[model samples]
Target: MNKDQVKGRIEEAKGKMKEVAGKVSGDKKLEREGKIQNISGKVQAGIGDLKEDIKDAI
Candidate 1:
């Protein structure tokens, strides 16, 4: 995978962990941070996917 894809996946996984930890520990701020991270990861991954698609098309 490209850098964006790899980083996105890592971020997504980390966010998921944080989200679970927040829920377990009753930390709303952590949960929110996790959600934002997850969204950012998804966006990054989408960009990576688009790049790959364009490369293939070309």
Candidate 2:
């Protein structure tokens, strides 16, 4: 719902695409980068979720 959440989800999707592309193209570097990006996105999304929870609890 927030900017972070939206951006993170978008990033996650992009990373997934990159991962798939990397696998198909046989690029280990690209695949690793994608995995990192995906993890980063998940973290960002988690942060957003935490913020939302805190706000709701207030």
In order, candidate lDDTs are 0.89, 0.88
Best by TM-score: 1
Model 1 is weakest, by summed lDDT over 10 consecutive residues, at: 1-10
Worst 10 residues of 2 by lDDT: 1-10
| Cα lDDT, model 1, residue 17 | 85
**lDDT per residue (tens digit) for residues 8-45 in model 1:** 88899888888888999999999989988988998998
Off by over 4 Å in 2: none
lDDT of 1: 0.89
lDDT of 2 by residue, 30-55 (tens): 99889888988998898889889998
Candidate 1's error at 7, in angstroms?
Answer: 0.5
Our tally of clashes for model 2 stands at: 0
What value of lDDT does candidate 2 attain over all alpha carbons?
0.88
- Name model 1 segments beyond 4 Å from true: none
